[model samples]
Target: MIRVVVADDQALIRTGFITILDSQDDLEVVGEAGDGKSAVEVAQRLRPDVIVMDVRMPVMDGIEATRRLAGAGVPDPLKVLVVTTFNLDEYVYEALRAGAAGFLLKDASPQQLIAGVRTVARGESLLAPEVTRRLIGRYAARLRPADPAVTAESALTPRELEVLRLIAAGQSNAEIAATLVIGAETVKTYVSRILTKLNLRDRVQAVVYAYRTGLVSPND
Candidate 1:
């Protein structure tokens, strides 16, 4: 079973998420928290497979909580799925940078929510293609130009470089396969190799890395 902790400041929202998650045979709501701090505490203690976090909560925000639990340099990072009513670009971008494995709008369908949790639990990121492009593109534009020598080209082969660029462009494995005229399995292998070579946690980080390294740009 995929253990989950639903964290939200509102009781109704928390119960609603718990109900939907518990309905799934493969998922279980092992814990729930009404605030960000409590969410962090319960998550650390329970070490659930996924935590459904709310962005805006008292005591501490979900972004900070995610950073604490799953951010960079942590000895052991937990998977976080951030759910927010606000679909604002800043919130989504910050959540991803804070180490959330997935970001879902609270208005997303129940099926989408369930799938988001499962995806994150399986160690994959759940970013919508359009959202990934818009949010990452918007934020990446503010970054300073990447160092001339620091790039994926040095570490990745030509094929891997192509795959990385497509990934940064928010293309799924199937999309990439079609675009590159390759098999889906081949695309998956390339993605896996890219992550391994780049030492990235998932596709989300790969997108960030690609942008940060100037492997791809917002215009691309």
Candidate 2:
């Protein structure tokens, strides 16, 4: 079973999410929290496979909670799936930067929510291509300027660089394979290598890294 913790300030919302997630055969709501601080506490103690976090809460807020649970330098970082009522660019950007494995609008359907949890639980990003382009592109200019010392060329081979670009562009392995005229397994290998070389956690971080390093741009 994929254990999950649902965190939200609203009791109704928390119960609703718990109900839906528990309904899934593969998912179980092991814990629930009403505020960001409690969410962090419960998650740290329980160490669920996935956390369904709310962006705005009374005590800390989901972004900070995510950072506490999954931020860089965290040993054995947990996978976080941020759920927010707002689709604002800043929230999405900050959540991803805080090491959330996925972001989903609260307005998303139950199936979408379930799928988001499963996607994060499986160690994959839940960002759809259009959503990624729209959210990350809008915030591209706000990202810190690329560090001159860390260039993609220095870390990745020519083909690996190409794969990273496609990944940042929000292409799936199958899509990338088709785009590069390569096999899916080859693309997967390239992705694994890119992550290892860059010391990135997953595709979401890779996208952030690509933008932070000026590798793949909003215009690209």
Candidate 3:
């Protein structure tokens, strides 16, 4: 089963999420928290597979909590899926930068929410194409380039670099294969190699890395 912890300041929303998630045979709501601090504590103690986190909370916010659990230097980082009713660009970008595996609007369908949990549990991100482009575009415009020493550009072959750019552009494996006129399995191999070379945890980080390196611009 996929263990989940729901963290939201609002009781109704929190309970509602629990109901929807627990109804699934493959999912279980193991814990709930009304604030970010407790959320972190519950997560650390329970070690749930995925956390469904809300942005605004008492004491600490979801962004900081996510950073604590999944940020750059942390070992054995937990997977976080940030959910909010607000469409604020800064919130989305900050949550991603803080190492959230995915982002979802609270207004998302129940199916979408459940699918998102499964996706994150399987080590995949859930960035909506349009929202991802806009948020990453803003991030690229505001933040400085990532450190030169950490860049793995030279580690990738030209084909791998092209695949990375397409990934940063939000293309899926099948789409990339179709675009490149290659087999889907070959595309998957390239993706795996790219992640290995870049040392990215997942495609979400790959997107951020691409933007941070200025390898793919917002307009691209």
**Top model number, TM-score:** 3
Pairs clashing within candidate 2: none
Judge candidate 3 at residue 162 and give its lDDT. 92
Write candidate 1's Cα lDDT for 52-103 as tens digits: 9999999999999999999999779999998875446577667887898878
lDDT winner between candidates 1 and 2: 2
Q: Residues 68-187, candidate 3: write the lDDT tens digits.
A: 999999889999999976556578777888999988988999999999999999998887776676677766667888875556568988999999898888788888899999999999
CA RMSD (A), model 2: 1.6
What is the lDDT, from 0 to 100, of the residue 61 in candidate 2?
Answer: 90
Q: Pick by lDDT: which candidate is best? A: 3
Worst 10 residues of 3 by lDDT: 84-93
Give the 10-residue window scoring lowest on summed lDDT in candidate 2.
84-93
TM-score of 1: 0.93
- Model 2 lDDT vs. the true structure? 0.88
Q: After superposition, how far is residue 187 of candidate 2 from its true place, in Å?
A: 1.3
RMSD each, Å: 1.8, 1.6, 1.5
Model 1 alpha-carbon miss at residue 32, Å: 1.2
